[model samples]
Target chain A: DTAVSQTPKYLVTQMGNDKSIKCEQNLGHDTMYWYKQDSKKFLKIMFSYNNKELIINETVPNRFSPKSPDKAHLNLHINSLELGDSAVYFCASSRGVRSYEQYFGPGTRLTVT
Target chain B: AQSVTQPDIHITVSEGASLELRCNYSYGATPYLFWYVQSPGQGLQLLLKYFSGDTLVQGIKGFEAEFKRSQSSFNLRKPSVHWSDAAEYFCAVGPGSDMRFGAGTRLTVKP
Candidate 1:
């Protein structure tokens, strides 16, 4: 069984279109995070939710928004998608805010054309 | 702000050869350290983590790392590396809400 899983392992969309990537975790963790891996392979944190409450948020574009229905799910939505939006997005979860280990999902490869 | 640095962008080693990947960090206080591995098209997997005690921490896949507060380094080492070990390795520092990762070192195994 997958601890953390993201749907649409590959997403391809045209510029200016809107898209969303869904993420879920079965680890029964309280904290979840969203990360973007650029072409250079640099992993940057975009947002984090602890017990469905927004916690860590980096300097991401306004077009991107994260919604967590509960502790098990955190979805990412992008409005007015641009070419720069192409990258691999990862979802992760930990037992708590300062847990030692965080589990990661396979990641969704989002490509904007 | 906290930051991590992996000096070598890439490293190559032969099967059964010893391997060491250097990682340095800049944090204000004592830090929680971790080493993660990511294969092609895969997510990050925690190889090991250091919270407290035990300077030398052992991890899966025959990997181990030493935590040195003096040099602010947490270098991953393996006496013998296998071909399957070829992948990207990342060093992260954080016990708090914010965990920062280094640029990562890509390992290539030679035949």
Candidate 2:
């Protein structure tokens, strides 16, 4: 079984368009996270949710919003996507807010033209 | 604030050769360290982690890492590397809500 999974593995959209990526975990984890990997392969945390509560929001632009409908799911919605948004986005989950290990999903590659 | 540094951007090794990937971290309090591997076109997989027990931690696929508090380092090693071992390795530090990851080191295995 895939502990963590992401939908829409590849997203290609035009500039100014909007898109959303979905993530789900079956590990019964309470914490979920979104990360961005730039072309240079620098991975940075974008947002984190614990028990459906927002816990960490890095200095990401307001255009990007993360929503957690339930503890098992977290989705990212990007508005006005720009060329700079072209990169890989990863979704991860952990047992709790202080859990040491995180399980990651096969990232979604976004291309903004 | 916590940060991780993986000085080696890329490394190449022949099959059956031994391997070591360096990782250094900076944090104020006692840190939780982890090593994750990402194969090409795949997601990140936790190789091992160091919470508070023994300094040496064993992971899947014949991988191990030693956490040295004096040096603030957690280096991953393998006695003999296989071609399937080639991948991007990341070091992370955290015990809270936020985990900091290194830029990552890409391993290229030669046949």
Candidate 3:
């Protein structure tokens, strides 16, 4: 069984188009995270939710918003996608808020044309 | 601000040869160190993590890392390289609540 999973393995949309990526974790973890990996392969943490509560909100723009319906799910919604938004988005989860080890999903490749 | 640095952008090694990937970090306090691997079209997988202990941590896939406090370095080493092990490796550092990652090093194993 996949520990952390994200839907829409590949997403393609035009500029200004809004979209959402769904993520689910069966590991029963308390903390979930959203990360962005750019073309240069630099992974950056975007947002993190602990027990459905916003724990870490990086300096990401307001166009990006993360919603956690529960501790097992955290979805990312983009208001208006831009050309620069082309990258791989990864979903991860940890056993606890303070745990350093994280299990990541297969990642969703978002392409904004 | 906590940050990670992976000096080598790419590394090439021969199969059955030893390999080492360097990682350095700058943090104010005792930082949590981690090494993760990413295969083609796959998400990152945790190889090993150093929170607090003997500083030598063993991980899956025959990977291990040693954390040095004075040097502020955590390096990943393997006794022998396999062709399947050729992939991108990332070094990360966690300070308190936030975690930051390095740019990653791409390894190519030649047979």
Candidate 4:
């Protein structure tokens, strides 16, 4: 079984459209994270949630929102997606905020036309 | 600001050749270093991590990294690389609860 899983490995839509990517971790971890990889393969943290509570939030635009319904699930929803929003989004989980090991799921590549 | 630097953007070597990937990090406190491998269409897999103690850390798939606190460098090396080792490698430094990743170095292995 996959330690972390993501729905819709690829997402394609037009600019100004809204979309969502779902992620789940079977590792029973308490901390989850979201990262965005740009075209240059530069990965950066967008948000971190611990036990369904938001802990870290980067300078990401308000158009991008992260929702964690539970500790195992964290979803990314983009409103009025722009061309610059196209990138690979990754979901990761760790045993705790202080834990060293982090498990990442297969990324979801989002394309905005 | 905490940051991670990967010196080489791309590296090429023949199969069975020695491989080394350079990484440098800037953090205010003790640097928690990690190396991750990203294969095509797959998630990032941790190769190794250095929290403290021995500077030399061995990782899965026959990979190893040495952390140098003086130079602020954590370099990943392999005695002999396999064709399957061709992928993107990332160096990350964790400060507090947030981890920062480098731009990544793409490895090309020749047969």
lDDT of 2: 0.94
* Clash pairs for candidate 2: none
Give lDDT tens digits, candidate 2, residues B6-105: 9999999999999999999999998999999999999999999999889999999999999999999999999999999999999999974799999999
Q: How many residue pairs clash in each candidate?
A: 0, 0, 0, 0
Mind giving the per-residue lDDT tens digits that candidate 4 earns over A1-113? 89999988999999999999999999999999999999888998999999999999999999999999999999999999999999999999988887366889999999999
Top-lDDT structure, candidate number? 2
DockQ for each model = 0.68, 0.79, 0.64, 0.66
| Residue A19 in model 3: lDDT | 98
Which stretches of candidate 2 lie above 4 Å from their native place?
A: none
* lDDT for residue A46 in candidate 3, whole number 0-100: 95
TM-scores across all candidates?
A: 0.98, 0.98, 0.97, 0.98
Please give, for residues B2-30, the per-residue lDDT of candidate 3 as tens digits: 99999999999999999999999998888
Error of 2 at A2 (Å): 1.6
Candidates 2 and 3 compared by lDDT, better number: 2
- Fnat of model 1, as a fraction: 0.52
- Per-model i-RMS: 1.4, 1.1, 1.8, 1.6
What does the lDDT come to for candidate 4? 0.93
